[model samples]
Target: MIENLWLIGIGTGSPLHVTGEGMQALRDAAVILVPTKGAGKDDLAALRHAIVTASGTYAKVIAFEYPVRDPSLPYIERVTAWHDEIALRWQHALKDAIVGGPVALLVWGDPSLYDSTMRIAERLDPLPKIRIVPGITAIQALTAAHAIPLNTLGGPVQITTGRQLRAQGWPSRAETVVVMLDSECSFRTLDPEGLLIWWGAFLGMEEQVLFHGPLAEAADQIEAIRQTARAEHGWIMDTYLLRRT
Candidate 1:
């Protein structure tokens, strides 16, 4: 039988953000696979290690370098190929670490939101029974940091990516849009006449930055700050909320 795979959401690099259930999941894991993007991105893996160490889970923690996607390929194809590579990595790591037992991965934010770990896990040859221990998401972190509600009154909200905003423009029927994995600040491509934006980086962390204003006014500052932060940290994960005013 395939071992159980636990996709545990750890939440925004804050130990306090981990749920009790998530901690228990970590404690129960026989092996935990942590992915590092490279030298400059070691903090991502370190944060996972910190949590595991603090939890006193006693699980064998193994760190592996994450495979990079080829940007020249079509976006979907590139992502699919990357996921396949990641699944292979997971299998290799599990084989070396766990004899035949439950394994866990500490996913940033909630695994369901813009996270492909679940999809990659599904590709395992003998699929393991999957369990998701959800944690706080960056969206929730952003809204809480800014003291704003995600939706106005009873209005609807759409969650999307930077690429979609650049290609399709503002979604016609939605009043609010939450954009994630955006490096381009694609809201600048839209007609800012009736739009208000709330952008946040490093949400729920001490280094969090938030800017809220008319899209036109905040776009430049957001871009500048984003560039500076990315250069300083060597990587960034930012999300923004746009509302039609």
Candidate 2:
């Protein structure tokens, strides 16, 4: 029986973003599962490996291949099946890696925000006790790196995804909306009038990039830079906050 299953948030990209609590969690686990999305995107896997090595944890580190989500299937359906496969992979890796762990899986950003590690873990049979060590989220990093406050003077803030923004224009409720998991620059679809945007790619890493201005003026530039970065690095993780002026 497993004692603890820790989903440690190691922040967006920077190893420095690993929290002390998360580091301790790594040290405690017997097996550390680091996942790779195959080729062209091994940087993430490397970063996860670096965290484990830097933590001085002699615990067995297991590197597993992540299941690629089929874009043809409906988004909901694809994600459901993908999670199931991922859970199965974790089960096999944990079983082979060792017995009775306190296993740790380093999650990107905070598991609470737009992450599915916990959801996938729930699918495992004979579930183990769970512990979460939250790290900095992309939005927090974005605001911090750019030196901007998340909310404007007691104003409401809503966190959402690019799909929602594209599906239903700007949200009618919140003065500020932070969008994540957006490969598409959905802000271009909205009326950029009176809207200010702060965008960042690679959040806290060395290749980090930041851009901000009126959405109308900066949207194109952002798209171009994002495309170039993705082409260069083979993958890019980004988030942005749009504030109504």
Candidate 3:
């Protein structure tokens, strides 16, 4: 029976982003779960392995194939089913690895932030005690790469996904917004006038890319860069911050 489940955030694609606490958790874990999401994402899988190796963890690192969401199902239903399948895989992997006392899953960015790891963990029967080891987030990485503050002075900041931005447009009365998990370049859906954008891809990693300027001027360029990077790498994780100029 699993006694402890650790959702350790490793940050966006960088071993260096693993915190001292996160490293210690790796060392203490009995089994570490690494997930591979099939073709076009081998780099991500390798990076996870590299992180575990770099941490010098003696724990057993078990790699599992991640379940792909069914495209035919509606978005919410598809994601729900996918998470269920993943939880089952996690159980199988954990049991196969050992009589798990403490198992760690390296999360890409903090588990609390737009990640489904926590939800999947909940699906485990007799839910194990969950612990989260936080790491730097893509938002932090994006802002740091551009040397910009997250919010306008004393103003509220809105953080959302690309889907929401596309479906709902900008949040009302919000001066600043951060977008994550956006593959569609949703910024194009909005009128670029009076907007400034700071965008980054593969943040905190060697192939890191950044672009910033007036949205009207940078939208096309950013989209081009995104397409080129995605074509070359086969997969891309990007985020951007938009503010009213």
Candidate 4:
């Protein structure tokens, strides 16, 4: 039988942001898996290392290169195949290192949000007992960095992706919408009249950027900064929230 598997949320790569329960989970793990996204994105892996080092709670940390999905395939098919490969990678890594013991993965932000760690964890052959330790998410970090509440008084908020917003336009009944995983400036497709947008990139990091104004006025600036940042870093994960006035 498989041992315990802890999916610990690390919260925006900041060791200070790790919760007490998450720290305990890390201490309990026999092996910790760190995923590398190749060279240009080595910083992503480095951030995890920094967290581990700062915590001073030594575990048998191992790094493995993450499997890249084929972009040419249909989105759903591509994701499914990618998850399968990742699961296989995890199995191989676990078998080679830890035998049967508690393993931990430092997830960026809260795994319960848009992350796929839970789905992939379920695909394990002999599923291990799973435990989730929640952490601050990008949305939370963004709002906190900007010093604004996530929702208006008595107003509901919708969280969605760039593709959905681009294809379907504003949600029928949502007063506030938070968008993530958007490569394109999907907000450009909106009418932009009387809409307010708060955009942030590299949230909680030293190089973080924040901009907010009427959608029409701030849209271009957001696009420019996003493009420049992507070019500089070769990858960027950003999120934004839109509120209609």
Candidate 5:
């Protein structure tokens, strides 16, 4: 059984995005687990290694091949199975290191956000004492890069995924809706009238791209840019904020 598991948020791509506490956790970890998303995504794994190195940590780094979900399975079933497999992978990765000391996993954004790390951790046979070392979230990074506040004069802000936005349309009474994990550019399905969008990709990274304008005018351009960027770099993680203008 894993003794202690530290879910450290490494933020987007910058090592500086890791907070002082996260850095210290890295330094203190005996073994760090890094997930490799197969071919064409080596940069993602490399970045984690670089982050660990930057922390000046001599901890042993173990890389595991992340499992791909089955497309045939329904959404909930597929995700549940995927998480189970990931939990099994974590167990296998730490088979020899449980007694070493605290084990750490570098998460891409805050664990409490849309991440499933905590849920995956629970699938472990004997749950380890889990500790979260919070770091900069993508939302924070996005807003900072845009120099915009998340809420509009104390108005409520709703955060949802592209899937939910596409399925539920717009949430009523939401002055601001922040969309994440939207590969489809789901905003295209919206009316776009009186809507303003501030979008950012690879936020907090050197290769970040941003666009802001009326949704009606900027949706197509944003999608085109997203397509080109995804083709150039095997993957892309982006988020956008929509406000009623």
Candidate 6:
């Protein structure tokens, strides 16, 4: 029988975003593993703590410090190694856990969307049967936070990363593009003319900040706020949407 491993999406930065299904999974799991990205991201681990408290789960909770990639190496190679290391940590931790019963990992956002907990989990030896509990995604949170629809009437949407947008420029055949995991604010590299932007940081959290205006007019302001927020908190996760008028 394949061992049970559950990836529970706790939503991004919001305990309220945790679905009743996800909470029930947490309450039922034999073990819950929370990733610790070190100090600046302690709040992320805290978010999981909040979920546990809210769910009223008494499951064994373990905090593991995730492996950090060497920035000097190529992205693919470095991330590949990082994932391997993380899997090793999980293997060691789970091996001796509460009878190796159903294991739960509290992931940010939906596990299928950009978040990589599932990829690392795939590397575990004697892989566990993977089950996912979906939660709100950053794009969804951003759009709702801004009171805007994801796309214009009948318009296609392109979702991409900052690196791809920076390298390939704007994508064709899409009226709206949503960018995530971009620490650099790559939107400034595009021609801001005829474009509108809605940017948000710490979405669904108390410290959330938002800006919306003509791209050319608000790009700088958004970057400035992003920098200030990052410096203030020592970390930041943000997303933005771009639409051509």
Best by TM-score: 5
Q: Tens digit of lDDT per residue, candidate 1, span 126-212?
A: 988999999999999989888899998999999999999899988878999999988888998998898999999887667778889
lDDT of each: 0.88, 0.90, 0.92, 0.88, 0.93, 0.89
The list of candidate 5 runs beyond 4 A from truth reads: none
Cα lDDT for residue 152, model 6? 97
Which candidate, 1 or 5, has the higher lDDT? Answer: 5
Candidate 6 at 139: error in angstroms? Answer: 0.6
Tell me which residue pairs clash in candidate 2.
none
lDDT of 2 by residue, 1-245 (tens): 45678999999888989989888888878888889898898888988999999998978888788999989999999999999999999887766555666888899999999999989989888887899899999988999999999999999999999999899888888999999988889998899999999999999899999999999899999999999999999999999999999
Cα deviation in Å at residue 145, candidate 6?
0.3
lDDT by residue (90-110, candidate 5, tens digit) is 998877764578989999989
Q: Model 3: per-residue lDDT, tens digit, 174-218? A: 999999999899999999999999999999999999999999999
**What TM-score goes with each of the models?**
0.97, 0.97, 0.97, 0.97, 0.98, 0.97
**Native-vs-model 3 lDDT?**
0.92
Clashes of 2: 0
Q: Write one digit per residue (lDDT tens) for candidate 6, span 1-245.
A: 22898999877788999999999999998788888899788888888898898998878987777888889989999889988999888877665565457888998888999988888888876887899999999999999999999999999999999999999999998899999989889998899999999999999888899999999999889999999999998899899999999
Q: After superposition, which runs of candidate 4 have C-alpha atoms over 4 Å from their true positions?
A: none
Query: For model 4, how does the per-residue alpha-carbon lDDT over 1-245 read when each residue is reduced to its tens digit?
Result: 33678899988756778988888877777788899998678888988888777666668888877999999999999999999999888887766574446888999999999999999999996888899999889999989988989999999899999999999999988999999999899999999998999999888777788899999999999999999998998888899999999
Task: Please list the residue runs of candidate 3 whose C-alpha ends up more than 4 Å from where it truly belongs after superposition.
Answer: none
Q: How accurate is candidate 2 locally (lDDT)?
A: 0.90
The CA lDDT at 99 in model 5 is: 51
Model 2: C-alpha RMSD to truth? Answer: 1.1
Q: Which ten residues in a row have the lowest lDDT in candidate 5?
A: 92-101
- Which ten-residue region of model 1 has the weakest summed lDDT? 92-101
